[model samples]
Structures are given as C-alpha cells and as structure tokens.
Target: MLVVKHLSGEYEQRDPRTKAYATKVKDASLSFETFELSQIGRENNGRADALSRIASAETQSLTGSIYLTEAKMPSIEKRECLEIHQGTDWMTPLKNYLEKGILPMDRREALKIKYRASTYTIINGRMYRRSVSQPLLRCLNTEEQHQALEAVHEGICGEHLAGRSLAFKILRQGFFWPTLKADASEYAKKCVQCQLFATVPRQPPEEMTSVLSPISFAMWVVDIVGILPTSMKQAKYCIIAIDYMTKWVEARPLSAITEEAAKKLFLEHIIL
Candidate 1:
C-alpha cells in the first residue's frame, strides 16, 4: 500500500519502493500516514504563529503602543509664579488680626502678634507679609502652605534636587514659609531615589575629631591575620590586638582559626 503526503509543494513517502499514485488493492488494508503529516503541519503552524506574534510585538514597540493606557499629557511650560489672595482658610487668623485689631487676652499672646500690625498689610482684600527683595511670605494655616510649596519644589516641576537647590527653586517660584530651607532639606534627604543615587561629598561636612585612648588597653582594635607558614605547633594563624593611644600590641597564634581559640586568647591576655 502506498499513500502520498504533500508538504511544501512536494510529495513525500516513507518507502521509495512504494508507488506514487493511489489505487485500491483487493484483500489489502490501506493506511495513510495522516498522523505524521498532521504532526508536521502542526509544527509548521506553530512556527508561523510564533513568527507572527514576534512581528506584532516588534511593530507595537516601534509605535510605542504595546499596551493601552491613559493618554499622556504634555508638561506645562514654566511660568511666572502665581500668588494666592486672602480668603484662603489658612489666612483667616492673620486677616482677623489686621482688619479687626483683635488681640488675644493673654499678655504673651498679645505681644507675640504685635509685630503682625507692622509686618502684615491688606492688599486687594488679601493679607500679605512684607519682606525685603523677596516676595511676601503669605501666612497660611499650616498644611495648605506646605502643600503649595512642595508642589512647586518636589511635585511634577521638581527634579529631586538638593536641599538648598530645592529651597531656592521654591523661593524663585514665589512661595515662602518659615522653615522652607529645613523642609526642603528634609524632603530631599528622604527621597528614596535621591538617596540611592546621591553623590558622596569630596570633604567631610564637619571637622573630624581625634579619638584619644587615655590609658593602655582603654581602646583596642582586634583583627584576624592568617595563612602564614605553619610552625612546629602547626600555628599558621594569628589574632592581633592593638591599643589606640599607647601603641600596645598583643597577638595569639592558633593552629586553626576558631571562635573558641579567639575567645580564650581575648579572656586570658587582654581581659584579665
């Protein structure tokens, strides 16, 4: 019996002696190699599908649309700092002190706010504080002012800069607060990405203080030095202890470096 399998536009058969044409043979069971042909067809289909998927992925990557997501918006151009008028919740207290001449009953409290009369002024129905050269530091209750300052300093416009730079950027954007420098410094220090990539300073920020060991054995540095030429006792490793101020030195040799040997040396020579 013989059968034909067409693959890649070519006829295929296992036995070369088998005839090429199909014909009915009497009293003989005919079987086609359909299973092998099907297997080969499946393999070709799988390869084709994989190639198609790879092509689709490459096309999407080039077009930058591999997955659907929120449409990105363009960044706004840097603009002049905008000022907020009074009527904000944070400004209520200062507004009251300026418009009504109201003072708290406590003498200390009254004295504390006395500078407000001179420092603060009403402009276009809003309360503002006077400052030299820089924009007026608007008095806001606490949270809102911090939020506004942070939005400019560390939000979308921010590039996770250093403390001084962050504060200066905030100031240039016309926002002022009492602890602007400290706040910016703290925020930048806590930024996870900034900390991971922060550059170490060339010089120490503060002068280093010398450590003084008042007496011998007062301050000791201990380390393990090892793998020397083995002697008669088979002691090839050594533990060294040095005094910081007095320049005192002590060493113990061991055949094999072990915790028990090191502890025994410390207790016998150094401790006792």
Candidate 2:
C-alpha cells in the first residue's frame, strides 16, 4: 500500500534508498505516455515473492553473486565534499596555553589565559571542557562546529527543534563551541523546512478562561483552518464545529465558503 502511494507521489519518500528508487521509477516512467502503479498481491506476483523470501533467508539457489560486487565503502560516503582544513580558531589561544604552558606577553592577558585554560584538558590530543551537569564537552573548531550543528539540527533523528532547544540538544550530545547558542538560533531561523511546516498560531493566542455550558450543546465554537494549498478536490478551507460541553467535533471541507455553506454544514453534520 505504502509502496504504491510512494510511486504515485501521493506520499513523500524519506528513506535514502527508497527515495532513489522513486526518482528512478519516475524518470523511467516518463518514457511512457501513460503509466500506473498497482498493488499486486504476492499470490499473483508469480515467483518474485518466492525469490525474495529465499534471498532473505540466505538460501542460495542460483549464482546471483555474478551480479554482485563487494563495496569498499557505503554509498552515502561516495560523494565528494570540500575537506575542511583545521587551523587557528578560538581554541588556538586556550589550546596553546593548556598544552604548552604558553601565554601572551601582556601581564593581564597571560593571567586571563591561565584562568581560562584551567577549565580545559587534552585527552588523546583532543580538547574537552569541564562540565558540572554532564560529562566533558568536546571542544569544536569552525569546521567541527558546523558539522555538529548540521548533524544535530537536520540529521536523521532531528525534529527541527527551536533555537534554545537545538543548543541544549547539542550540549546533551556532548559538543560545545563558544558561539553554540547564537549559531543554533541563526541556523533554526534559516531552515527552509522549519519555515514551510511551522505551526500557524491559533486565535485566542492568550490563555482561555473555562466556560460552564448549561447543557451539552448550549455553548459551541467555530474555527476555520485555512486558505491553504488547494487539494485535488479543490478544498481550500476546513471548517470545524465543536460543542463546548461534550467536546464533539464535526469538520467539513470547503472550496468557496460562505455563511450559507457554513450554515448548511453545521445543520447537516452537527445539528442533525
């Protein structure tokens, strides 16, 4: 069911391998004037299901190894990206003082460096910061900071958390840089996906006072969902009618909504 929906583009493909397959399928389908995907049960799919079951069970019936090649690395790692060359950064001064007992010439600056470097330690040539709440946080350079923030904010497990939450998550993940909070705020604000699906603040944005309904249907509330992306049936708005007492909800879709349409929906779906 899901495979058919993904092929038809009714549902989004999120898995890397499945998304790749979907793209290839759509591209190959472009050659045909008409194309359709249908769900064929295993019973009607001939020996294909049997072959898959055999393959999954690791029962080799034939030499399919003729078509196989041992991959040296994963497919995800095959891409080329610019290598980040590590260099002098905010960590340079502190690292220098911590590792080599080096300090600036200025008396006040040298004392400052001495105090600051005391909170850090090097293990296996990597710097880590002392933390009271959790384990040592691994100090990051410019490149490491970018990589950590990217992976945490938009990686597989990421939920596109807000600024402070994003920073807190990174801290929990045991990474830190001087500008962590500021960078997290900036990154979350600029995230295209976050903006697209962001929640629309409902009316009565402030706290609501509870009202005592005299009866089950005595008090009611009405809300309109959107003038949103039109659906295939061309519905652009959703009207919801709710009874305050029983909390029963009746919702209906609308294309061109008017007071009359709202009235009819409430009468038919709710009152009836």
Candidate 3:
C-alpha cells in the first residue's frame, strides 16, 4: 500500500521590489520537467495480478485524441498516413521530419536508399555503386580512368572493387562507365604505370627432359646468354655441365655462381 500527500500554500501580497525579485527567481527555475517510472515486484501473485489489471484498465480509460487542435488543423489525409505506415511512399513524412530538424530512423533508411540509387551503375550484367571514378570513367572513357584504376589496383585487389571506389573518387572528376569490356581489359593489362608499380615477372614453363653425358666436367659447354634482361634472376652468362656418354647438359648461372655452389649442384646431379 502507498500513500501520497499533496500540500497547497498561497503567497502573501508583496511590495513592488520584492515582487520583481520573486518573479525573477520564479523565471530562473528549471523550465523542463522529467519523470521516470519504476516497476516493483510483489510477494503475492494474486496481488500483483490485481494491481496489473487495475493499471491496464486505468490506461485504457485515459485514452484521448493525440495531436488534435480546437482551431484549423493542418491537412493530413488518412490515405497519406496509411501510405507512410503501410506502403512504400515515404517521402512526405521524412521531408517533414527533416524540415522540423528531427532525424528519424526511417528517414535515415530512405536517405540510404536515395544515395544508393544516385550512385548505382550496371556493369557486366550486374549492378554496382558508381562511388568510384573508374567505373564512371569506364563508362565515359575519360583520360583519368587509367590513372584511377592504377591507384585502385595498387591498394586493392580486383576482388574488393567496392572498397576501391572511394579511392577512385579521390583521384579525378567523377563520371560514368563509358568503355566497353574489351577496352577496359586492355587498359588494365597494358597500363604502364601499374606495370611499373605492381606487375610481377611470369615464370616460363619447364622444358622437356634431354639426354645427359656420362663423365663429370668432361664436356663443359658454356652458353654465354639466352633469356631477356627483364627476366627475374637475369642471368647474362651460363656454365653448362655435359656428360660425354649420356650426352646430357645442365646449364646454370655464372654471374655470382661460386665454386661451393657449383660443387653442391654437381653433387646433387652427378654424385647422387
């Protein structure tokens, strides 16, 4: 059981100076009111149920018209409300809330949808965001596309196209995809700037097995050069170990090849 007491008091009539001070003090009091409701557990189930029933009944009886005015009401049609709540026509209330400086969750969702719609592009039979200048440049075939894609591929693999879009936006003036797939592929493959930075030398396929000589260090065939200067481990000179009987030749580097290294190679190939 709870008891709440309400006490009332009246202020005495005051002098002008005193009245002004009192009015000022009253005005200075905090303008906002705040309340909090707390639920308490009861020992008895029956008493709790009765209290809950009473509370529910009181709540149902206290209902009244919300946002109703005595004077002329603003035009809010029932159909509009139904559309906002049920159907996908959500612009009006969102705009109203935004205009009133209120940011609702629904408004944020609508804003996301609008942003995505504005930034989206269709490429290779799939829809992607036009957040990148490259995709737009790909559409427009602008001179800046190569530079943008180079920067994108530098930091990101082709797998993370979405993440690279922001980088493209930072590089050049944003545009739409204008180039065909073949052109785009050629640009990616041939971009000199990207090749200088990110391209790796491809390893050549192994040659078929050939016959070897019998004796060790007998027919020492020395091939001066073969492969290009751009190849990885660019060997300019080669020392070949050939077997007289087997007629087999094993060629290796001569630039930095040491005696121990050659001996190790000979042991692996000949001694074993």
Candidate 4:
C-alpha cells in the first residue's frame, strides 16, 4: 500500500482509503549554472575553427604521429604574442616575470650560451621561444591553455579524440605549454564520458571477503522502518528483527514507536 500526499500549494487532507490517489504538488525546484554553458560553447567553437584552419594539413596524411596544425608547420615564421594572464595557479608569476623580461636564474644561466641565447627572448611584453622553424606560442594562461586542450580533445570539433591527436591539433594551432603531451593524455584518460563508455576491466583489484558468521543465530540485527500506509488498525510502521546465523526473521507493525514498544519487541523477540 502507498500513501499519496498532495504537494500542490494548497494543503490537503484525504480519507485513508484515498492513499492510491495522486495529489498535485507545488513545483519546488531551484536552478543555477554549475559551469558557464556559454563559455563551453565558445571553447567548442574555437576548436572547430582551429580544426578547420588545419583541414588542409590533415589531408596530407603522412602519419598519425605527425602534427599538421598551422602553428606547428615548418613554413610558419617565428612571431610573438603578448597577453596578460589572471589566475593564482603556479604558472602565473613565472609567465608574468618572463613576459616582463625578468629571467629566473636557470634561464639566465642557460641564456648565456651563444646557441641557447636566441632560444628565449621577450618582445612587446610577451615571452617568445624560437623553435626549429617557428616560435612557440606562449599560452595566454592556464585556463586558456586548458580550454585549448579540452577543445581539441573533447570539444565539438573533437570526436572525443585521443590525447595524441588532441595535443597535435593544439600544437598545430600554435599553442605551447610546459607539459603539453602529458597534460593532454591525462585529460583524455580522466574524461568522464570516455570513462563511462570505456571497456570494463577484466580483473578485479582485490579478492572477495569471506563470510565470518559460521553458525545460525550467531548474530542478530534489528531495525524499524517505514511511514507506510496506515492500515485500518492504524499501523504505519514496522519493527523487524533478523538472526544473522540462522537467517530467521520476525516483524511487528505499529502506529507509533516508543521506547516501551522497542523494549517490548526486543524482550519478546530476542530476550525470550
């Protein structure tokens, strides 16, 4: 048997027999955004645009290992793009100082070498690194860098793509970060959708637990449950007792539960 309560704005009382009837309840729902949907859409669009920009390069089809993004192509020349980053993440201050022409001790030492000196240089409030054929596009900030990776890996233009492909696409589009490949791989592995659809593991991590109760009636458990439909006798709750060793069970219904009722049940069912 089931009890139906009217949830509609107006308070209602119905006869006991009307338990099966449905009552309209007032709408009680709250709404807020957990993440900015607009921002996600923008990221997807950016991914699509980047993919489109590299569509020609993708057609060359030499090997999956090769990147064909416009940013990574050999034909592209070195350039600098300066932008401010706003975040408390670790990379913030380092990038800030580099863009401001302040090199850390390690970079200063490395820059002293004639060959390595041209590797890192500042232009127009931005840090630029000259690679083999093109300058690495210093990522604007961590969020934008993450967004770029996510866009390439799982955004609209992405078909839930793999880490390698995602990283390649981002690189081709001219973005550079410290752990580009590693970050892309980790992100792909952690994608909730990918995990949801992934194949199940064949092996269990641990062995199953062995049962400890060896004899019947060796252990017992008891509990009260329910705001059940009130019967003609006004019983709307039940007290249940179970013997762990024997799997024996007993129950009694009640309209109300009290210390006296519980004591009575315990004494009658277990103590006796």
Best by lDDT: 2
Worst 10-residue lDDT window for candidate 2 reads 59-68
Which stretches of candidate 2 lie above 4 Å from their native place?
1-87, 204-272
Give the candidate order by descending TM-score. 2, 1, 4, 3
The residue pairs found clashing in candidate 2 are none
Residue 187, candidate 4: Cα error in Å is: 0.2
Ten residues in sequence with the least summed lDDT for candidate 4: 20-29
Q: Candidate 3 versus the native: TM-score?
A: 0.18
| Candidate 2 displacement at residue 30 in angstroms | 62
In angstroms, the error of model 1 at 166 is 2.0
Considering every candidate listed, which one attains the maximal TM-score?
A: 2
Off by over 4 Å in 1: 1-92, 202-272
lDDT of 3 by residue, 84-134 (tens): 344322233333333443444786765765554455444564333354424
RMSD of 4: 27.6
Colliding residue pairs in candidate 4: 7-25, 7-26, 8-24, 8-25, 8-26, 69-172, 71-172, 216-245, 217-245, 217-246
lDDT of 4 by residue, 138-250 (tens): 65467777888777777776777668877887888877776888888889898998888866687879987755577776777879999999999999999998887777888
Residue-wise lDDT of candidate 2 within 1-272, one digit each (tens)?
A: 78899998889888988887777778889999999889988679887675555544543555665343446765434477899876689888888888888899999999988888888899999999997778999999888888887899889998889889999999999998879999999999999999999886778968899788999987889988999889999999999889989999888888977898789987887778
Off by over 4 Å in 4: 1-117, 198-272
Q: What TM-score do all the candidates reach, one by one?
A: 0.41, 0.44, 0.18, 0.34
Query: lDDT of each model, Cα atoms only?
Result: 0.67, 0.85, 0.47, 0.65
**Candidate 1, TM-score vs. the true structure?**
0.41
